[model samples]
Target: MSNPSSKPIGLEIDLLETQGGKVPLEYFHKLISQLQKNHSLDHLSASPASAGEFDVVYIILSKGTLYEETETNAYECIIIDGWSCWPAGFAYLLVPPNRRREKANISGGDNGPSDTADIKIALLPIAQTRGFGRFVIRTLLSHAFDALGIRRVTASILCPIQPSHSVAQKKQVGFNTKQLCWIFEKFGFKFEGISRGALMSMSVVEGEEPVWHDVHRMSMLITDYFQEKRSLSLSAMRSFSREFPLKVVQQSPWEIMIQRQEKEKHDVESWSKRPNDASANDACGNDGEASDDETVLGGDEISEK
Candidate 1:
């Protein structure tokens, strides 16, 4: 079932700039000026077909100035100024999937980039729960399959352990490997295998030696993405249209996490105060496992330019 609106997602960078969200006038000017000054689009030359440590320099901004009209459109101020504003967040696409290159420039034909995988992601702490992660990745899928003509996208992630926190003090982006993997799952990614000690610790305390955590890897094909999107749209319509007031329940895609968290917290508090009867125990079977999982990080990746 396709969306009621018959528009196939148009996701070119130029079009994304206008419709996604408002990039500050100054920021937009600065980004274009910098790209012009540095001719940074050359970074796109890393054909997925060419492997074994290629270099590409990228510009990233620390300060995120993203605006919104509707919730699903994920526009960014993508600093690309080659810097980080907050110590914890910013998003960058590391060595994008392979491109269909011309024969004169062809090296490995189809094998080199066919299975290309490095896609690292992170976001500002404030931005994580707002559904920016899903929006950005969704846009990326469109760009990868439609614009670049990539057949598939593979991601190797260092997923973090899950967390539990009180309502007031919640953990923002870091060790959110699981959160990232979860979103990827919805958008047609499958869990592969975990690599032991594949990632160093995310702690910053003194006298803390680096602890090893496993890395999680996943991949998705363009065909799967189309199927997933169709299913999700149909599910949304069916799930909400019958029971809930469709007009009143309208929300940005990102608010799902926020609303769910509020519901979970209310449930936990309600149960915690309830009488310690078998009925209550049966009803509250480890509801503590449900916590905020909207936060994920996209760490920096260095490649040969």
Candidate 2:
């Protein structure tokens, strides 16, 4: 059933910031506290759409932050809007240093690990299906490929077998596993396989037996990112922008890459037409790798402007 109190609307994503593992203990508490008191999120704690249905939905639903540190190389990120500073959600990335070393030991370091990373996300109920999820994933993928230079990004989505229910009265609260799989596929992530018992139960009830759930593992390589970027049409881009309605205080790595590529292309064209102009040559001296920004914007026509 559609939420009576909620309406589907564009979300204005203002910021995506990451903090090191050394984040103060109190910061987590503050975030959790703010989320718990926000009445707009009460549904997520009690409704089927609650993140608790898939993962351990704490911090906002329960008493504690559900924060844990298993990997030393992981980083936590917060998403917010610049206008009202609304906390939309949280995400984390795990980048292991040993991956490169292990690959080097096996293959003489020529191809190495290619810098693989893993990401997980948790969004508030108020932010669900508002295109904030897409924005977050896009920004993260851009950061992984361009800023961190990661070659592959992986995500494990919970896809447990849900209990059978009456189909007639069934109300869709949020994206089911199948829909989520389709969404990720559209983003160029390939389905790897099912990971049986991939996650442990995070039930808050006392004396409850622990249960495990299966997850579908999916991955996207840097090559996949490039291919998707090239294939993305102007209409699709406009749709995404309209869905998210972003007013970013900090540009995502993807946006930065686009601007850089545009500047470099302009410089090269200027130098080509003015061979005698030393300034043009100097400006275009750097052999920067080209991006698919222009091609994506122009789509089939391929614009020069």
Candidate 3:
């Protein structure tokens, strides 16, 4: 709960940095080892810990912010021991090579530029309940939308069929599927659907076999991101400490506000250009739209976890 400014202490590292001799792979190994030892993250899906598994790695530092950029500073970031340069959490994005641009038919017509990517984030137990998650998410989404030109970002969260734990044990575990969904929704992600039997259970019960579990799918479009930015109050923006600079391309609070204003103007123009028939269908909910009952059923998927 500390981090009053909600500013993220982040360091960006390319997995290729190991091969380039910029940073050694052993540092990353230490990070993964410490992350695996944290029992609180058992409920979440395993991320790309190995060098070959992911393209980029964003390391969120602890206590203070990252200032200078040096090999020693980078090594300190990876050496997460919960004391000096503690890693609060990590996040990454997987972008397919030769990805084709696709239209995001959110408003019945061509809204704006659209592309897609997938994201994953995990935080240490000590970092939770603080503003670390918010900072990480804001940075990731900003990178995806602004730098990468990604219009839609998807997240598939693991939802266990039966979590092995008592009431007390449950308290120590990280956010469940429902809590994660709620948190993501707060960040403008919409519940897409659930993939049945998408992942094997990460929990282990003595003498019991691991069971297949579903994955909750959610997404945030560029429009949603704009809306989220517009809804935030100026005071909320000020709460973010600008002292801790992130290692990625992120918009400032004032920049976000300016972009929001521009986007609002663009939206009005786009709305005026939309075809009448598409608008009618949207109003009537006639284009294979989910009924209220079906929507309720989808919402119920997150009720358990």
- Winning model by TM-score: 3
Give the per-residue lDDT of model 3 (tens digit) for 134-206: 7767877887787767668887787644655676554533256678888889888999988888787755576
> What tens-digit string does per-residue lDDT give for candidate 2 at 281-305?
4664445634355445764476467
* lDDT values for all models: 0.48, 0.54, 0.63
Q: Mark the regions of model 2 whose C-alpha exceeds 4 Å error after superposition.
A: 1-82, 98-114, 160-175, 204-206, 233-305
Q: Which ten residues in a row have the lowest lDDT in candidate 1?
A: 40-49
lDDT of 3 at 270: 88
TM-score of each: 0.42, 0.46, 0.54
Candidate order by lDDT, decreasing, is: 3, 2, 1
lDDT of 3: 0.63
Better of 1 and 2 by lDDT: 2
Best by lDDT: 3
Candidate 3 TM-score over all chains jointly: 0.54
What's the lDDT of the predicted structure labeled candidate 1? 0.48
TM-score, ranked from best to worst: 3, 2, 1
As a TM-score, model 1 comes out at: 0.42
